[model samples]
Target chain A: MDVLINLSLNGLATGMLIFLLAAGLTLIFGLMDVLNFAHGGLFAWGAYSGIWIYTATGSFLVGIIGAILTGMLLGILTERWIIKPVYGNHVQQILITLGLMLVLSEMLKVVWGPNQISASTPSYLSGSWEVGGVIIIKYRVFIIAVGLAVFLAVQYVLKKTKIGLVVRAGVMNKEMVQSLGINIQKVFMLVFMIGAGMAALGGMLLGPYSGVIHADMGMEFAILAFIVVVIGGMGSFSGSVMAAILVGLSGSFMAYYVPDLALAANMLLMAVVLIFRPQGLFGAKG
Target chain B: MTRILSNRMNILYLMIAAFLAVLPFVYDSRSLLILLSQVFIFAVLAMSYDILLGYTGIVSFGHAMFFGIGAYTVGVFMKRFEPETSYFLLAVVVTIVLTAVVSYIVGLLTLRLKSHFYAMLTLAFAGLFLVLAEKWRTVTYGNDGFTFRVPEFLRDRTDFYLICLASMVVVFILLKRFTNSPLGKVLQAIRENEQRTESLGYSVLQYKIIASVVSGVLAGIAGILYAVSLRFVNTSVFTMDITLDALLMTIIGGVGTLVGAIIGAGIIEFSHHWLTELAKVHWIFERWIIFFGIIYILVVMFFPMGIVGSLKKLKFSRKKKDSVPVKSETVSQGD
Candidate 1:
């Protein structure tokens, strides 16, 4: 029972990180019909920039903010330049974004030097607490809390705010939204920025959770995020969270029980999901 | 047959083949033979990719899986069995059968999804294969791949180079015929518009599976040549980089043009060879992948239609401006 609880907690934390990345990916895909393969680059940049700032400033909050800002700034540039030209063409988008993915990863090697950087948990969130023989890691709890908070906040905005309404409308029918005189292009840029920022936030938090970050980690995790988006339903935010947790928990448990099958676990899940529900779990029927 | 021989493009192809076939005898340079052999192997791989991406409009991210399957099958057979001609032949047969089955299953499973979904699923499946290769240490020897001896006949560098060239030419001609057939026309129609093709009574899924199977088998053949050339096989055969190389080749040459894939492969392979060579001169050249990535972006942005496609477009426009009565049949045939 103890081991199970610990595994679930670990899975949930990892799921949240994946959710941060997938949320942005799903939103960008939903609203703009643009698949940004380089979103992972923003995630990696966030981790690198955030960790650097955290080390320099000796403040975790400042580091987190710095990472988000860096992600948004890079997001804007990517949106304005790389993604803008290949907007309607899926083939061009895949090729260009993949190129960007490579450039971003290689650039990380260029700037930071080709080496993995070790990260430590912040002083305040370094330890664990044991209650009734169930120990909970502080950092894991912190990650889950942040994930839930972000989910709720984003949910509120989508449900209540004017910009959120426009974004949702754009997802359903961009032409219809444009016919209503909304500047869908600005919304696209805005959504791309927010999505990139969230991915970066996920990367920042992932630094301490894993205790190390590498340039190639972005590609690795980006694949996970893509799996989540597929299983969750491309445009469904809530579905992404559910799918993320499912992937995380399956991965966590598989690692413990069937060690040899650990890596293949999530892939198997995705295949099963795809076979039964091609539109994804929460996706609307085509 | 005589009509095909008389065509201008076919004559150009024959001349190139004749030149390449004789060069190995006239010029006794070992390095050039090796480089040209490598180019031939990759050209086959890229053209196989063209059958799917160019002819059928399917963007697969798991092509390396078939390539890896081929390499590993040959590698394992040669290593475990005797390094004899019979075993090598058996390995080739097994690779074709395995690749066909795997591609069929994969196509059936994932082709039902939308474009991006299909791409992501194929990628996920490829990752699964990579993990399997990594973990199945008993057979694969894990990530530290093993090297094995080849058949006695293949030991000669000149013989192997000729073999690679022959295989490439044969595959190219076969594919050209495949693409110009009535079925190939249907595949092209699907590429232009899937729903419209389905409405015209063609089963889109079946045609996609056929293309996938052909592409997979050809890629497997290329993998066999690649492994035989190096006399080694490893998990790197399954990496995403191999698939990306094929994608870049197909796009940079020309999407639907089989010949363009060959040109793309040559350019990319030469650039790769030269860039790494330049590392000896400049420290900056040590990180050649950055330049590769930049080239990819610039090509997509400026040369979206690729080298062959853009040049063709330029020529067509110039002819139009010249007030020449361009034949509509020729324009449609070119497309």
Candidate 2:
């Protein structure tokens, strides 16, 4: 029973990190109809930048803020320069973003050097707590809490705030929102920035959890995030969270019980979901 | 099919072929022949990719899987069985049949999904194969790929070059014929509008599956030739990099044009060769990938229709201007 609880907690933490990355991706895909292959690059950049700041300043909070800021700056540049010209052309978007993904990944090697950097959990977030026979890691709990807080905050903003409402309205019907006189393009840029920040936050958090950060880590995790997006339904925020948890739990259990099949398990889950519900679990029907 | 190449184009092709046939005698540079042979192999691979992306409007991210299947079949078979000429034939046959079957299954599962969904699933599946290759170390020898000796005849560079060139030509002609068939017309209709094609009573999925099998089989053949050229096969054959290379070649050459694949492959291969040579000269050139990425971005931005497509458009415009009154009809149809 304690093992089950421990595994569930681990799975939950992993799911939350994926949710953070996928949340932004799903929204960006939904609102803009652009597949940003370079989104993973931003995640990797966040990891490197945030870790650099953390090691330099010795403050995790400052490091997190730095990563988010870096993501926003990069996000603005990507939207205006890379993504702007390729809008409405899926093939061009795929090709250009793929090229950008390569650039962002390779540029990391140039900037930070081609080696994996080790990261440590901050003093405040280090250690574990024992409850009866079960031990809960503090960092895992912290991650889960942060994920929940972000989710609630995003939900509140999206449901109750004007900007969030406009973004949602645009996702539902871009032309209708434009007819209502909202600057859809500006909103897209803003949402993109926000999404990048979230992905960076996920990256920053994952650095400490994984104990090492590498440039290529972004692509690997981005694949998982894409799967989560597809499983949860493209453009659905809550769906991303639910599907992420499912992926996380399955991955956790499969790794422990059947290590050989662990990676294939996720793809299998996705295939089953795709076969049964092509639009995804929470996706809107076209 | 007749519309694909004009009499002038045929003459141009014949001249190029004649040049290629005699160039080895003129140059006799072993290194250059090897480089050109690599380009020819990739040209075949890129053309196969075009059959799906350019002609059928299906953008797959798992093409390297089929390529890998072809390579690994030869790699593993040679390692286990006797490395005889007959085994080579058997391996090539197996690659085609295996790739056709695998592609059919993959297409059945994935072709029904929307664009991005299909792309993601294909990537996921390919990644699965990569993992399998990595983990099944006994057969694949894990990351350190096993190298095997080819037949005595193939060890000669000239023989290898001629074989690669012959394979490229044969594959090109066959694919051209296939793409010009009535089935190819239906695939194009589906690309233009899937719903309209379906409404026209064509089985969209069936046509897509057929396209996938042809592309996969061709990609497998390319992979086999590539492996034979190298006399080695590794997990790298299944990498996303190879698939991206094929995609870039198809796009750079001209998506729907068969000859464009050859041009695109030559440009990419030659650039890579020169860029690496240039890298030795300057520190800035060391990061050739950045320049490559910039090139891709620029091409997508300025020349999305690609070199061949743009040239064809230019030719059409000139023809329209030459023929009075026909200009008005063509101008309105431009979009």
Candidate 3:
């Protein structure tokens, strides 16, 4: 029971990190019909920039803010310059974004040097607590809490705010939203920025969680995020969280029980999901 | 069919192949021979990709899986068995069969999905293959990989170079013929409009599977040649870099044009060679991928249609200005 609880906690934490990345990816895909492969680059930049700031300022909160800002700034630039030209063409988008992904990764090496950097948990968030022989890591708990808080906050905005409604409506039909006199381009930029920020936030938190961040980690996690997006339904927000948890827990349990099958497990899950529900779990029927 | 055979382009292709076939005999430059051989190998790979991406409008991120299968099959066979011509032939047969089966299965499973979904799923499947290769240590030798001896004739650099060159030419001709057939036209129709093709009584899924299998088998052959060139196999064959290299080659050369793929492969391989050479002169050049990435983005933005494709468009437009407007449509259709 203890081991099970611990595994679930670990899985939930990992799921939350993935959720951050997937949330942005889904939103960007939904509203703009643009699949930004360079989203992973934003995530990696977040880790590198956030960790650097955190180390300098001696504050994790500041690090998180720095990472988000960096992500948003990079997001704006990517959307404005790189993605704007290849907006309608899926082939061009994939090729261009993939090119950007490579550029971003290589630029990281240029800026931060071609070596993995180790990160430590903040002083306040370090260590664990035990109750009734069940030990819970504080950082894991903190991650879950942050994930839930972000999910709820976004949900509220999407449901209650005027901009949120516009965003939701935009997802349904961009042309219709545009016909209603809304500036859909601005909304796209906003969503892209927000999405990039969230991905960076995920990367920032992932630094301490994994204890090491590398240039290639973006691609690795980006693949996981893509799997989650595919399984969750491309445009469904709530579906992403659910799918992420499923992927994380399956990955955690499989790693423990079937060591050899651990890596294959999530891929298998994605294949199964694709075979059965091609539109994804919560996606509207085409 | 005879028109295609007697086309000026065909003569050009023949002349170029003839020139290349004889050049190595006189050149005696081992580096140039090796470099050209690598270009031929990648050209084959890129052309296979072109069949799917340009002709069929499919963008797959998992092409390296087939490439890796071909490479590993040869590597393992050469490692275990006597390095004889018969065993090498056996490995080649096995690679073709395995790649066809795998590509068919993968196409069946994922072709029904939308473009993005299909791309992501293929990538996941490739990742599965990579993991399998990594974990299956005894057979694969894990990430460290293994080197093996080749057949006696292949031991000579010149013989291997000629083999690679011949294979490239054969694959190119076969693919050119295949793309011009009625079946190839159906595949192109599917690429242009899947729904319309389906409404026209074609089984869209079946056509896609055929393309996938052909592309996969050819990619596998490229992999075999690649592994033979190095006489070694590693997990790197399955990496996303290999797939991206093929993608870049196809896009930079020309998407739907077989000739473009060859040109793209040559340009990319040569640039890679030149960039690495420059790395010795300048420390900054050590990180040449930054330049590669920049070039990729610039190509997509500026030359969206690629070198041959852009040139074709330019010529067509100029001819449009010179000739009657009605003739422009016919000329464009010829492309």
> CA lDDT, every prediction?
0.90, 0.87, 0.91
Model 3: lDDT of residue A264: 88
What DockQ do the predictions score, one after another?
0.74, 0.65, 0.74
Better of 1 and 2 by lDDT: 1
Quote the chain B TM-score of every prediction. Answer: 0.95, 0.94, 0.95
TM-score of each: 0.96, 0.94, 0.96
Model 2 alpha-carbon miss at residue A156, Å: 1.4
Query: Per-residue CA lDDT of candidate 1, range A1-286, in tens?
Result: 8999999999999999999999999999999887778988999999999998999999999999999999999999999989898778787787789889889988988888889999889989999999899998999999999999999999998989999999888889999999999999999999999999999999999999999999988978888999999889888888899999988888889888997897688887778878998878877743
Candidate 3 per-residue C-alpha lDDT over B1-335 given as tens digits, one digit per residue, 9 for 90 to 100: 67766888888887898899999888899999999999999999999999999899888999999999999999999999999999999999999999999999889988877777667767777888998999999999999999999999899998999999999999998998899999999999988888999999999999999999999999999999999999999999999899989988998898898889999999989988998899899867778878878988998887776889888988878887677756555333321
TM-score of chain A of 3: 0.98
The DockQ of predicted model 3 stands at: 0.74
lDDT comparing candidate 3 with the true structure: 0.91
CAPRI tier of model 3: medium
Clashing pairs in 1: none
* Shift in Å, residue A201, candidate 3: 0.6
